[model samples]
Structure formats: C-alpha cells, structure tokens
Target chain A: MTPALLDAPAEDRLAAAIGEMARRSSSAVAIVAQAGSAARCTIDYGWLSRAIVSLEAGIDAGRPVGIVARAARVETLVVIAAACGRQHVPVAFLAEDSRDLVGQLRDWVEVDDSLSLPAAAAGERGRREFETVPPQVIVATSGTSGPPKLVDHSWDSLLAAARLAEHWHGLGWLLAYDATRWAGIQVWVQALLTGGRLVVPASRDPDVVARALVEESVAILPATPTLLRRLLTSADRGLLCRSGLDRITLGGEAADAALLEEAQATFPQAKITQVYATTELGEVYRVADGRAGFPAAWLGKALPGCVRLAVRRDGELLVRLSRDTAEVGTGDLVQRRADRYEFTGRRSDVIVVGGAKVYPKRVEEIVRGVPGVAECRIYGLPSPVTGELVAGEIALADPLPENATPESVRAAVLAVCREHLEPHSVPRILDIVKQIATTPAGKTPRKPHS
Target chain B: MRPDVPNAIVTAIATVLRDTGRDTRPIESGMLLAGDLGLDSLDLAQTIVLLERSLGCDPFRSASTSRSVRTVADLIAIYDSAVAPGAS
Candidate 1:
C-alpha cells in the first residue's frame, strides 16, 4: 500500500501525495518517515509490507515467530496493543513482573523488544503533538488493575456464548482493539463465521485505524467508547463519512449519554450497541437503541438461564453465569435513569483522598461548573501520603481565556473545589488539555500506593 | 539526620493547614497534629505527601509508621532518619 496521507496542510498534503504517487512507494514512505523521526513514529510502509508477508506465513504454520513491531521503546506495547490480526495462538498480555501468569498459557509466546527496527532510530522517529500519550497504553497493562489478571481463554471458550446472526454476513468489521483481547477475539470469530472481512489496522493510532475503516469500506466497527471518542476527535469528518459503517459496537468501558448522542449524530446511519464483557464472563450484557446502560427490566432477569444480570444495593453489576453459579461481581456501578440503568463508573473508580471518599463524578461535575471549564474528567494519581491524590483534566469553553496557562485554570478550579468539597477532596493536580487522552481505552491505571 | 527535617515538616503542616482554612500560626515541634493543630487524618496525609515531594523520601515506606503520630516532632524524626546516610 502507498504511504497514508500525512495530517499536514491540505494543499501541501495534496501536492506531496501527487508527487509521491508519481515518484513511487518507497519515496512516499521515506517522505512520511523523514517528516518526524525523533520520538516514536509509525512503521514505514516498506517495513510493514515485509511484516504482513511474514504474518501470513506465521499464521499458515500455526506458530508465532515474532513479527518485529515498529515503535522503538514501545515495540512490545505496540505489538501487545495492536495484536493486529486473528491469531491461531491465543495471546494474553501479562505484566512484565507476572512470571507466574505466563504458565496459564501452554503455548503462549512473548512478543519481546527484539523488534524489527533498532531501538535508537525507532524512539527517535516522530510522535506528534496530538498523540499526548506514549505507546505504553493503560489497556495493555493489567486490564483493570488489581491482582495481575490472567485470562486463560481460547477461541472456543470465548465463543461458547456468542449469539450469531445472519446480518453479520459480508460486513467489514474493524479490529479496533488488541486482537488477542476478548472483544477483539469475538469480533474476529464473528467475521470468520459470517464470511465477512475483518479490517485489522497495522497501528492503534486513530489516524491509521480511521484510514483503514474508510479505505476498506468497513461496515461494522467494534470499539471501546474511548476509542470511538478518539476516532471522532482525530479523524477528518469527511473521511469518516466515506466509510459505510452500518454498526458501531462500543464495549470494554462505560458509554455515557453525551458520548452516545455524539456518536449517534456523527453516524446516524449506523446503529450503536453498548456491550459489557469481562474476562471472567465472556459477553455479559448488551444495550441497543442508543442508550448508556441496559434496560432496567433486564436486571435480575436470567439470560437463557446461562447469564443473569443484577445490581447490588451499592450499585455494582452482578452476573450469575448459570442456575448453579453464585453471582459474580463485574466491578461496574450502575444507576437507574428514568427507564434504564446507566453505568456510573467502576466500583473502584472513587478517589479516596486521604481517608475521605472523593467521587470522580462529583468532582468532575464541580470542575465543569467553573467559568472557563467546558468539560472535565477526574482521576486519582498515586501518592504515598494520601491514599491517592485527585487530578482533573479540564477542557476550556470557546473564546479562549486570553493566553490561559494550565496554572491559571487550575487555580480557578481549586478555588471552587475547596468551597464545595471537603479539605481532602480538593484536586492536587490539574491539566488544561485540548482533548483529554482517551484514544486507547481511557481508563488510566490508578496505580496502587507503595 | 538531616538538619532541615523539622523545619520541612513544620512547613508542610502549615501548607495543609492553610488550604483547610485553619490557623497557620506557631507550628511548634510538640504540637499534636490532630489535637493542637486541628489537622485530621487526611490533613496529616496531605502533610506527609507534601513532605515526601519536598524532602524526596517517605519514611513510612521503609519503617513501620503508626497511624496515630502524637506530635509534629515524631513525624519529623521519622523522615529525618529516612534521609540519613546509610538509612533504609
């Protein structure tokens, strides 16, 4: 494939595209690679072509010989995050320290840093300003931090509960997450079963994933709400519209009404589905008709006597796998909103600043009330002193605060929080971000205190 | 032991006290955090956190730290020994 068009000035990009198409593929690759080769840059097309060919051979042999991933310092993270295509060998990402967890997989192979490119040049390659987060994404790390999770699952075990539909036939499904991941594996099987196309992007970068979706004429897209938000924020609106997306499945994280409304407006043609799944429970529940959570009526109702969904008094969603099984906790909290139950946050989503419980939702609401604040997200940062310190990611309203610094906006938010919240609930850290980092699973680990 | 540990501890306590709209006067070494200074457990946590950032160490990490620290001096002593050369 020719080098993907650069997110440069429209006219300059067009000229560069025309010139590259004239000069040939390698010239086009060199131009893109040369533009930014200082941080972590995307793998050049020349390298990707070799990797794809190797990928085909590896899958045919049914053995994973490492396909050198492109990112320098984050090569392992890239391979783990993008676990690009359907793998015959079931892959599970383990934390570097969890040596024991590796035993859970009998034939698992570690995709190490023996990457295709040298560490020196790979790291030096350019990462853009828009790509705020490094390639070391949170989703790749201990999926929702606790005891390092080990999901000992195979294609058959995961597909045991899948409800197949004839409508899945011939639709192009975008592999928007780690293919080894539960959601990714499910998408792959659905595509395989339906004789449909699974468009696996070479990179998790929104630009690359969005381009693949559009260029491949992908009809079905499965992604986390965070990934969908990133795609909407990063991709050109016109380019996104070019894709014939008939279905958008959001899972792996909670989907809010605002995000649902935004996605609905962006792709009115596509039907949105909010699905919730866990490593323990394959695909727990699904909600359609453009709502945040499943219908309250679905609560306490058993799904074919296989998986029954219920909520705790404190709001955690509980699922009973079968008639004989005890209710298993999903760690997600849900709230009844008129006709439906909307997932509020995870049970552990609270920020306990010192000894007091500081709800992120409460803090986010107060932060959003500040004069210039248009949007805000609340999360905790690890601190030895307090159990965890409260942090806020704030996006400003239009007509920018005349040369506003993060410091200035933070000071204003601090003033408001102090009045409404307890002494311990005030956010210690605040960032004025253009777009909060949510591209790759927005759940940044609230690292346990030492 | 570092000479500035007592002074640093006092400063951190004062900072947390200021944020909570409490009196920021006469932060003596013998002043009990909860009793005399009116600093709650969370306020004490804030003080320890601030001290860790400024002093570049957390004594609680190496040595067993009691939740109920009686006075400012006890808190200072814990950190002072932590930063001492050859200290754990």
Candidate 2:
C-alpha cells in the first residue's frame, strides 16, 4: 500500500483486489459512505467495476502521478483504482495538507465528487480474474511524533496480515483512519478483500461515529487508543457498548493498560486486537491479549516479512524490517513488566521532573482508576523550580457518578495520587477539564509547552 | 491584608503534610518549613505548585526569584504581598 512492471501498475493492486473479491456475489456492497451525516451512499462491486473501466480510459499518463483528495470520498478510491488500472502509480494527498506538496508533485490531479464516474456500459462486470498484484501506492505517515514521511505500499504488502476467511462475509468495518493512510487503508482493503462492507462515517466526531456504528452495526473497528477513549466518554456511550462491534482494532499509538482495560469493558463482546505496526516497519505482529503491550517472549523473534523486534538500552523499540534492512527506531518506549512488555510512553514524551523520569502513561493508569474520572492526560509543565513539573488534566466520565462533584473528584484524584505515586511523580497542578485535548492525529500530547 | 490568604496557606501546608503522613502539631507561622515541618525541597516545590493552583499565583515565579523563605510566615508573606493590588 509494491513490485511489478509491464501491464498492471503497482498502485492498482487494491482495486484489483476489490475486483477479485467482487466475483463473490453480484450484489455485494463494498463501501458505505456518509458525508456530513446527511448524504448516505452505498457503492456495490458492480459500480466499482464500472468506475474502474470508465476512469481507466481517461488516464493517459504512463508515469507516476499525484491526486489531491480526501480519503472519506469514494471518488478518491475510484480515481486511484482507475490510475492503478492504467499502470500509473498514484500518490494521495489530503486537500488541506497538499498546499506545500502541490509544487513538488510531478503530475497533480484534483480529485473530488465533481469528477463523475463514467456510466456502466450495457451489462454488469463479468466473472473474470482482476489479477491482484503489489501495486506501489504512495501513503504518508500520520506524523504524530514528527513530520509526515511519504511511504510506498501495494495491496499485497498493505494487506499482508489481513484475515480473508469466508467467515468475514458481510462484516461492517469502520474506516476510522484516513482511508488514504496506512491504518485506514487496512480497514478499507480488509473490507473489500473479504465480502465485508466498509463504513465511512460523516466525520471523526464521537457522536457521529457512534451513530454510524450503531446504525450500520459496524462489526470491525480499527482505531487509535485516543479515539477509543474519547468514544467511551461520548453521549452515545451506552449505545456503542451494545452495538454490534465484535472486532475492536487498536493501532496508531501505543495501547496503554488503562485504555485497553476500559475499551475491553466497554465492548465486552468484541475481541480487542492491538496491532503494533509503523509506516516504516509495515504490518508487524498483532496482540490479542487484553494487555497494554506485546508479549516479552516476542523479543528477538522473527515475525512475518522476516521482521524482528528489539529494544534499545533507552527503552525505544527497534524494528528491523528484513535480514538486510537496517533497524527502524519506533520511538515508542516499552518497559518489561513481568511476562509482558508494556509501553510506558514515547521516548520523546518522557517527563523528567528534578532529574527523575516520570512516565505519563504510568500516572494516567493510576488516575483513570478513580471512580469519576473518564480520561486523564499527564503532561510536563515548565517550572521555575524544577526543569519540568508533573501536571494532570482529568476528564470525568460521561455518566456522572452518583453524589459526585468536580470538587470531590479532584480531591479523590489527589488522595489517590498521594497514596499510590511517589512525591515527585504526584501531579502538583490538577485541572478537571471537560475533555482531554488531543492532537490532529487523535493522540494526547504529553508536553504542555507544545 | 486579606485574612483568607494566610488561612489558605496554612490549610494548604496542612493538606500536604497530612497527605504525606507527616505530623502536623505545634504548627504556627514561626515554624521553619525545613526543620519544624520537616518539609524537604521536593515537598516545597510541590507546595508552591499547589498554592499556585489554589491561590492563582506563584510569588517566587513573579516579581522576585532569589527570595528565600525560612519559616511558614515567610512563605505566607511572599504570597500575601504578591496578591496585593499593586503586586506583580
């Protein structure tokens, strides 16, 4: 999301994969898109086959080209499939974030709903082989910790770890990640590869996403831990719990114990799978255990694609893609806790107060246990006394606790910290925020200065 | 001077002491934070931040930086002065 020359381009593997899966049934729905919670649309395999044929004819370029589009749009996939079908590699760019990249891209094509899908000729797409191959499609990293880096992938490489058994038929999957991005592409491809229907919410807003989930009965949800935590505190908390969410996929950031435990409790029936993968390392091993981090025994073990996991002395996990490729530092700090290696926090996110390192993840795990607390963010605040001081922002649970006030919750948070944590690790500055602030990528920023 | 400023300071000190399981007896303005109260430097740092949260300002962080406090009254006086109308 890789290698092939001659006829079929590297990028169209995803479309071909969809074309291949399109043979399962004539009326199989592949995509469910809800724009602005108003326009609900459904695209079947017959439509996809039509769009590919029509769009492929309009493309004349034989080299790589770029398209400025949003993944939420089905047209983005249509154009990408058409370009890939024509053997022209395509690079995707978000409309807003494409300003700085427009001049850099060799051949930029503007993709929107206005680019109509050519009408289907005569009959439905026939039962023929689409020849799914690794077509190199350019995608960018989430740029959570740093600047976004463009990476190349194909359907074969992108969906390498995708489960394609027939049992996945008609499963409703939520496109929680940007359909143009890595995690989002996985959900999109997985839904298409299997006979599942991919659900695209109007927006990432918790209320809208929750409504889409319950309405569509989305079974498979691939999301970041931050989004999961926010959804737990949403107004539709009760509905989401009872929804048909059987598979909860957590990725993007490190899944901490508190978030994992809460997500498990919220979706008790759903099987929680934490995927430890990066844009550079591609799809690595997955953890199904309801724990925070991967198993300790997985260390130095070679996973699929000949990738092995190791840790630096400073606690950063090093992922080596293959036998020959150099190790890629994940920047994720993992600590060994007995049998399992739990991700304490990011190496860059460590809060050092008075020379002692304080992991915000450890502090958040303690704060999240408080009865009234819904979510909490522990960050480092600049201090005249210490280099950095520990500060906490707490967001109370959705359903207010009985006989509980903000004053009582704050007091309980303080008492719990004093009882459990060390003096320095205890947050001196406590704020009961309505909600914990998150980055654009739906991650809690640990540095207050930022 | 506002009576609540010194009162809140004493209450904040007692809250910290009680939370830390330190003995809070014979406490007065004359009591030394380091010796009589057995408040370590780390505890003092925490006290300043807590006071900032409750009282809204850190005296040491504004107007003055080198000012040192030996007793509880000195710490109380620093905050009271900062909260004054003309105080920074």
> Each model: TM-score of chain B?
0.86, 0.86
Q: Considering every candidate listed, which one attains the maximal TM-score? A: 2
lDDT of 1 by residue, B1-88 (tens): 3558888888888777655556689889888877888887566656766777789887766437654578887887778777888876
Residue range with the least summed lDDT across 10 consecutive positions in model 2 chain A: A1-10
lDDT tens digits, residues A20-45, model 1? 33334432221111111123233332
RMSD (CA, Å), each prediction = 12.1, 6.7
Q: Which regions of candidate 1 fall more than 4 Å away from where they truly are?
A: A1-143, A147-150, A160-166, A232-244, A302-307, A321-326, A348-358, A361-403, A415-424, A429-442, A448-450, B1-39, B60-81
| Candidate 1 colliding pairs | A36-A126, A37-A124, A37-A125, A37-A126, A38-A124, A38-A125, A38-A126, A39-A125
Off by over 4 Å in 2: A1-10, A19-27, A35-39, A61-65, A70-78, A81-85, A95-103, A116-136, A149-156, A233-238, A257-262, A265-268, A312-314, A325-328, B1-88
List each candidate's DockQ score: 0.24, 0.25
**Model 2 error, position A271 (Å):** 2.4
